[model samples]
Target: MVDFTFNAKEQEIIREIRREGLVLRKYARYYDEHEEELPPDEFPEAKEFAHIDKMAADRGADATSPTAFYMCMLMHRTWGDMMRMKVPFTALGNASVTAAGTDEQKKRWAKTRLSMANTEPGCGSDSKAIETTAELDGDEWVLNGEKIFVTTGIRAEGSVIWATIDKSAGRGGIKAFVVMKGTPGFELVKKEKKMGIRSSDTAAFVLKNCRVPKENLLGMDPTVKKGGGGFKGLMKTFNLTRPGVAAMGIGNIMACQEFVAEEMAKEGVAVDYEAGQHKRSAIQQKMIELEAELEAATLCTLRAGWLADKGKPNNLEASVSKQKGGDISRRGAQLALEILGAMGSTHDQLVEKWFRDARITDIYEGTGEIQRLVIARELLNYTSKDLT
Candidate 1:
């Protein structure tokens, strides 16, 4: 029942997309080196490919698997370059809003690209410790907080800011609100200097008595429910994106392998599958191991994405894929550099950049430790409190 390969229509579209991706790959290094400058919203070459989507009108139902194919495409994107070429890149907040927002809130901000504002100066891995506060006053909700490491923070039309309505209520008091960028009392503090993914903007913000209509509250109800309130409802958005983060790792993995393999090929080294270990050189042995790891991690990602497409719970699977993808890509890039030696670290090649870029895929969606904890709790049927 599981098909690993895409249908023919999907295949056709993927090929064309990759064809264009190769063109963008030319600018990867340019953006990587100039981390301070955000990639242009639209490349001048975009005009040539403007009709790419409409060209897919005749695709069959076999190509309709959205989440699964999307994972495949994410890998393809990273394979081309870590610096993305898409204009007006989609924001992480958009997914959260779709998952937890009131129907009216969704309709109101249908076109707004929203970045997620969850991390605070003090809060990184443990989202439950968020210090941002939200209070309802008359027709508006007053929000006061500082957000850091906000992805797409500079380019997002708005942000889905998370704040606790009552810290005493614990996680139950946390909720999300839609705050437009130009809203009074909302200030862009500064952009972050990063080791990788520089083309994508990361920024910080300060909200001092920032007020938005009370209706902008996601999920509409702010009374700290018996549980962590709307906190769990908002966190559920990661069920799909965790696999997405893994897919990014998969892309880097594929790139790392290909780069090393090509370098080996130039030196007249071809990987021989049938050879015994004793006959294989040390480099050949490592190549085989890297290939095996890449295959395993990719399978884990595909399974997680497929589960999402089926409307099934993928919490355990998502964490598994995320950890696998994160670990492999990080290691693979390092191994690739080791194989290439001095030339690898030099800006002459991209392996060094991959080493830097591959790091975040694991850390952001959730740390490796968090993923392992999720896996443990799921296996033991333990709630958060029980596991902690």
Candidate 2:
């Protein structure tokens, strides 16, 4: 039941995604150097990639699980750039909407690109400590807050803003609302200059007495439960995305591995599968080790998916996969650069850019340290850590 292999159809689809991703790869450095420019909504070369969701892949009884298949799809999609695609991806909040939004809420914004406004100037990992507030007046809810480091904030037609209705109620008071771009007081304040992934826009927004119909509220429930049930439901979206983030790193490193292998081949450093350690060069051994490490992380990602497909909770495993992914991607990219020496550091090669990109894998979605804490708490059976 925990098999790590992809079926024929699943493998074919993933291969297609990676092949199409090459078009995006060609532009990775152009946008990396030109951080102010956002990638086009669609690349003429890889237009078919934008419709990959429409591909009909019928798996036989031996097909891969839905969760695993989705992870692979996301993984290969980012084989070129971390989050950049030939097409702009629907913001992550879309996943939150699909998971926690009410039926009417889902229908209302089925195709809207909705950014997530969660992190604030003072809050990053501690989401519950958000200072944003939501006050109801009449049939509208007034919002006041500043959300920073929003991905795709500039391009999203709207955003899902998080504000606490009753700060004292803690997590239960935190709620999600759909706020359109031209809302009375919602404004895009900043488009951050990030260290990497410059192809995608990371924005900051300020909401001043912004009001939307109360029905815009996700879950459409105002009663704040003591256990923060509604808030937890939205957080589950992270469990789904953490591994996805990891898979992106995995996909990137796979590209790195290919690049490195090709470079080595050019230098007559051919990798011999049958060669013993005594016969192989140190760099060759390192390449093999990197492959093993990548394989290990890849398996962790699939395991998280496997757990989900089995209808089991994967909170702990998600963190494990993400931690492994972030670690290896950072390590793998750095090692690739080191092996290439000065050329690796030059803009002439994407390996240097990937090295910069690898740093973020550990920082976003949840830091590698936070993931460790999650794993520690799960193993010890301790109560949830006080993230607030």
Candidate 3:
């Protein structure tokens, strides 16, 4: 046993997440404790994601430091607590609220709210294709469209939804709105049963004539700015949370490595030495490579996270971290399966579940493809025009 312990500040937040995570797990268990059996559809999972999301938001609503937030993530990984995703997801929402919300708006909806951006159904990668619409109606904003794959939308008391204020403006015309739940037209239609991170829930929502007060608009009105009027605003959250997502990936990497190593020992194999020196087996060599990859992935993710802590804008670094972490996760799952042979494929062992869950990290947030594009853009000095 690692017997991991945190420093004072870290411990405080860790305790908070652990306590809250327990509450969340109990709640989730009520509906379905069998995380492996949930359907990855769109409705119920969304609702489940929503519930955990709220609890996480509440945990951090009063924290004074970002390090505390980071500690929450570490505690989650250490405990193998998937419900801690809510902490980062909620932090993402808070970033947006802090950047764009009015004082009053922040007070009412943001103090403990969970907001989301990135990942849509048709175009999770392309922010330009967001079909959600927000039209100014008198003193209220009327929203209409469907958002599929909202991580915490199912249970969030409110959300800061991104929508296009001007269709002709394209990405430039998009704006964020702080919409409340049960606002007449906002409906959580489904929840998803995910492959990994089974404890966390994902959702799809429909907005039909969902009316929110005009004061809920994030950033200035679209007509007041040019070129994705609020993109810069939304980017704030991404910059802050993406590294944390990379951290989550790192956690998964560490988990797989630990599990594999432990299992290998039980099978009468010492994983610390090269395969050839012992059994001289090709399978052993493959396992060695998997362990090495896990190490590299862990370092990459930690490096990016450390940079963020240093007050640096490390978008490229963050993308690299996530890309490497995602790759390592996939490879780790494959290697674990091979180590266990036939039994590895069984969901009863959790290796299979981890493998399935690892796939989502590459697809969500900015996707592996998007991360590559981002890295290329940064290295090549490419302007926004080069994105297409």
Most accurate candidate by lDDT: 1
The superposed Cα distance between candidate 2 and the true structure at residue 348, in angstroms, equals 1.6
Flag regions of model 1 displaced more than 4 Å: 55-58
TM-score-based ranking, best first?
A: 1, 2, 3
When 1 and 2 are scored with TM-score, the better candidate is 1
For candidate 3, lDDT tens digit of each residue in 332-370? 667777777877776456556656666766776787788
Model 3 poorest 10 in a row by lDDT: 36-45
TM per candidate comes to 0.96, 0.93, 0.77
Candidate 3, number of clashes = 16
Local distance difference test, per candidate?
Answer: 0.85, 0.84, 0.64
Task: Using lDDT as the measure, name the better of candidate 1 and candidate 2.
Answer: 1
Error of 2 at 21 (Å): 2.3
